[model samples]
Target: MRLWLNRIGDISLREQLITQIIVGILCHELTPGQRLPSTRDLSRRFGIHANTASAAYRQLESEGWVELRHGSGVFVRTSRPNAPLSPEMAVDQMLGDIATKARKLGVSDAFLKARMRRWLALEPPARWLVIEPDPELLRIVICEMEQAVTLPVVGCGFEECSTSVMLEGSMPATLPSKVLAVRKLLPTGTELVTLQVHPVAPELQAYLQRYMPEHSTDLLGIASRWGDFQRIAQTMLIAAGFAPESLLVRDATKPGWKRGLDTTTAVLCDAAIQHDLPAGTRAIVFRLFDEASIKDLRSHEENLTTPDRN
Candidate 1:
């Protein structure tokens, strides 16, 4: 990830660097375990003083957004606290407080240590549980997730998210719109990954501009297993000035859905149902997950599959 520094802006260079790097990590542009540029390199590239760059990196490390190892340089941290804490001093304080509390509660130090180790050794996520209210949308998201990551993908509605069977050994993920609600339903300490939806309007607009000139009445077909997907595409095309009568919509869940598609100019469909389109039909697939979201899922999958030697 490239950092853009505003040398002339009201914010100090150190503050600008810190803010941009934090934004990159939060947006998944700079992923967990990814190495950050050295302070020297950042200084040279941005024409900032070495101390300014170093201060920004030190602040990031202190805030737990990154880890600065002695020889390994700085890496983006995997865990984020619900509240900010100084990485070294605050962590030491936290552990000491825990020990003090345990002693006051009549807990043995050895037993406390053993329980802490067990919590640290708890199993990583074994699969993904996609939480969405719409069954059809859930299925589409699961299909996209399965293709993007190695982990097994399953799904349930928001109400079912609280069920033990649905969440056990599974990482809970949901669309951005449902993130807050899903977070409330998950167990405490369970992190919810927000799935980013792909924006379809730009692609659709570009295609129309390139192929279908304005006022040209070519039959455009939209096919998808999800009825909402078909309806959305139909609406977008119509909103772009394509007459409603010039569009053919097909729901792949129904019979004879592909029969009339081959005769149309082109078919726009969801990625899950694109293969089911008629053999001769020209297909444009609208994917559910954006590339960055897919990359984040794959990163989580990698952590699950790769064992920790330490």
Candidate 2:
């Protein structure tokens, strides 16, 4: 049996082996009751640790894709008696067809596996947990995501998200900048989704384009508890030809954050902190998730609601 392994990618060698073998079986390249390579042979051929190969085989066996014979070797399971096609079989067929089409299009196995990982990551979790170190940003993310997804959305700091929450099958999401830190806090196999920073909303952009040149010398105050937002807003403003000196950025979490915004012509802040702005302050609400992100989120929610055939 031939197995493709991606050593430099996020997927472990064991998982790569298991996925490939399953694909092989589903594609009928490996017939039922066909003997598989020994763990030692697999280890040698794939240049993986012997233990990794053994673990892959063990997982395949536990999943009923293959069976291990004591003192002998592993083999694909023989056909069961008069059993209907299981969900697992259906999934395999679908995956096999996908692989065939992708191969025909000259797509490499590594690229296909990477795409698979991305889609798998999109699978809906039992709940959406927004992980933000700042309480205000956490609240903003939760509120925004709640509007975008139908699932229960909650917020927590990095430390507040305990192992129990992860064990409950929560999908922890965070800003792109904070993903690495969040991933380090989660258990292995936990999926960490990154919320993308979007450009200023279209209406806001239009307003800026229409009026900014007239008020080119006016101060543009930008406030948010999310550092990413502050930075993204600043970058976008500068890219739009707004003078850097005309921009006043603030981290709302800091003391006296509102001290300098009073002289600004307008303020841009996240919806969660909009209420904290001085009364009568002209504010343009900046959103983190854009239309594309929202569409992707809707797809994820659909995937979550779809019943597993297995």
Candidate 1 stretches greater than 4 Å from native: 1-113, 201-205
| Candidate 2 error regions (>4 Å) | 1-90, 93-126, 132-139, 156-162, 174-197, 211-215, 238-245, 260-263, 306-310
Per-residue lDDT of model 1, residues 125-149, tens digit only: 8888889998888878888887888
Question: Judged by lDDT, which candidate is best?
Answer: 1
Q: Can you give the lDDT of residue 145 in candidate 2? A: 87
The TM-score, computed over Cα atoms with residue i paired to residue i, of candidate 1 is: 0.63
Worst 10 residues of 2 by lDDT: 1-10
Q: Would you give me the overall lDDT of model 1?
A: 0.77
TM-scores, each model vs. reference: 0.63, 0.49
Model 1, residue 51: C-alpha shift (Å) = 55
The residue-by-residue lDDT of candidate 2 on 243-298, one tens digit each, is 66878888998999998887888998887788899877898888767778889887
lDDT of 2: 0.76
